[model samples]
Target: MPVVFIHGVATRAGEQYQRGVAAREELIRRLLVDRMAASDPRWAGMQVVSPYWGDLAVRHYWAQATLPPVGTLEDMGVGDDGVAAADLEVADLVKEIGNDATGLEALGAETPLRNAWSKNPHRTVEALLAPIVHSDRSVLRPQDLGITEQARPAQALGEIDGRVLAAGSLAASDEAVGAAIRDALSDDAALTVITDAIVARTEQVAPVEASTDSALESLGPGWLDTLRDRVGEVLNRAKSAPARVATLAALDRYRDGLHGHLTLFMGDVFVYLLRRGEAGSPGPIVERVREAIADAPRSRADEPLIVLTHSMGGNIFYDLVTTYEPSLKVDLWVSAGGQVGQFEEMKLFKASTVVDPPAPPMPPKVAALGGRVRTWLNIYDPADILSFLVEPVFTDPDAGVRIKDLKFKSGVSALKAHGAYYSRPTFYELLGREFGSRP
Candidate 1:
């Protein structure tokens, strides 16, 4: 039972990117490395593996996609402004053609313009200049017109006059004559290039790898089921006193079934003497922990299988020991910043069928194992809000091992309660002494 660390919600894989701030990743790295170092002598040769779950990817995709554009407008600039201005002048020519329709009729000729420009001058201009303004080869900028930076105004005036003449050649019936004139005055190549560039940039920054199915499969067979069942059973037992007793009974039954590797059931998140259910099931969290454990090489039977869990992780470990791996005895059980002492839900135990009588202090589950299990050390920082400051909880009379609470100032001054127990040197020293290689 290698020390398995189960991160809290939103801290899993894929979700790492969603941490947003750099500090979060740093903190996680520090905690992980520190834990490994603390387990140095006991787990000196063991590996530390962090599962790359997909929570971060999901979070990033949802959050980044909705952001506003960040680049400057100049970055998208094209010389289309001159062409646009020329299109404006073409409308005047279209209007002249429309008004001359009556004169053309007198001359026995059909109206050259299709519609009256008087109704909408803007449309008339757009129709006459559309082609030339939209053409790829058209050079609508000051540079293309051979005009210096200082002579842009003069060049623009000259271009506008030329566009007006181009619009005049179209028949009155040609409603799009004005659009063609404007099209001749501007170059669309620059605009096209800019648009393509913007699209390419957008695609480049898009996120990749948004799921983590592969990561989960890295664990061995039947791992998921074992984890789920263990968590469910422990959570169910913690709900009632009788169920807690029943849970102990169930552990005993399982112990009798297995032959090799003895089992030691730890307490729920609450570290207090009371078997009250405080921390929830360890199922989901344990899945990752198990995966990491599976990554390590299996050892000899005598080698201690140490499990060091904190907060809710301790609860999960307890479930696994009693329900799933009864014969697989844990050599050392280290609980830090534990919340098992605060379990308020003992009613669930009364309703359980596992216990003969469903009330009062629940009986220990280890009795069924006939004392094969060894040491159980429960460590706590006084500042940890979740642990009991003055007392201990998980005492096994038959096993003669009492739950111990160790106190230290967690150095962290802000949230001076729960998390620091995992980071402090004293906790590390205790872990190293039990699990680290003995020199």
Candidate 2:
């Protein structure tokens, strides 16, 4: 089975603000693809597809404008407090026009023509030229198009964390340290000895002086105590040499695990769409996944399907499998920082009328998929605030395999939350158990 990758909200192609940003995103994609190909020779045959879906751009002007919001058809005119009834009506009409254009796009119209028609040029031109002195201006200048900066790459990638590391400049010292660690791991020393060496080296590097001594001095004695406490916490955590070694090993495995044309499917929370009860309605999202999966090169049909989904992506996968090939087996389904067990809260059927008539539920656990789903592993980071603390609401622990939740002291960062599992070594180790054995 071919793996399919999906990006989270507000991250899509042709939706960038700056051309430079788009280049960077393309760079990230290249890096990921290259890294995966290098991990396994088979990965060279893997097909990678990034579907481009436009995201809504929220602007201050849109928030402050005297127009009714876009989603509703209600009419409210321009006013000091809010849009007037007439303005609201105009906004609604504009939205209707945009929707019509979107419908055309869905039916295969090119983007430029779709966007042009969607703008309702007559109304927009009237509004813009209204300030001009000319009573009859037939020609509109290109500058009058009111084009703003497109979305940028920085907005899509967000910030980096331990897992979702960005391809950018790093602190020279940090780079050197990381390089040294990698070098040490490359040696065939026993895991224990290698770990001890790393720990000793880390301890030898004394803490650097704060850049702002004056700022430190301004703090009371209590501040120093707090700083000391934090330092102690770090030292204490460092003492767990065995665990740290395991973590390093895991990271190495993850790095080594990407082989053949692997597809990484990322999941997000229900909050992505902000739909109150639509988290479980897989219809809205599954079609994209199917399309992506179908687009992958079929040369490596026997290659294992490696799926890593977080939060709502879990349910989305369920819908995909059930709808397309309920009998289709997968190599692995890794759920990290997910809420898959909370099927009741998910209310999968209640969100959409189409989903209301539920299909016969599959066995609650991952094992029940039999040969169809080889292994379903759920990994949780203790520091992830959004993840469920307990097992999912589903029954049959055997069907759904649970692993020791890997605890990273740094916790999950903004870019790392939900989608970071694929980037982490621990995640790679789990994948290695299935895919890495070939090499």
Q: By TM-score, who's the top model here?
A: 2
Lowest lDDT sum, 10 consecutive residues, model 2, at: 130-139
- TM-score for candidate 1, residues paired by index: 0.36
TM-score of each: 0.36, 0.39
How accurate locally is residue 352 in candidate 2, as Cα lDDT from 0 to 100?
19
lDDT of 1 at 380: 65
Per-model lDDT:
0.34, 0.34
Candidate 2, superposed: residue stretches over 4 Å from native: 9-44, 52-284, 344-371, 389-439
**Backbone clashes per model, in order?**
56, 28
Q: Candidate 2: global Cα-lDDT? A: 0.34
Error of 1 at 264 (Å): 30
lDDT of 1 at 199: 29
Report lDDT (Cα) of residue 68, candidate 2.
Answer: 35
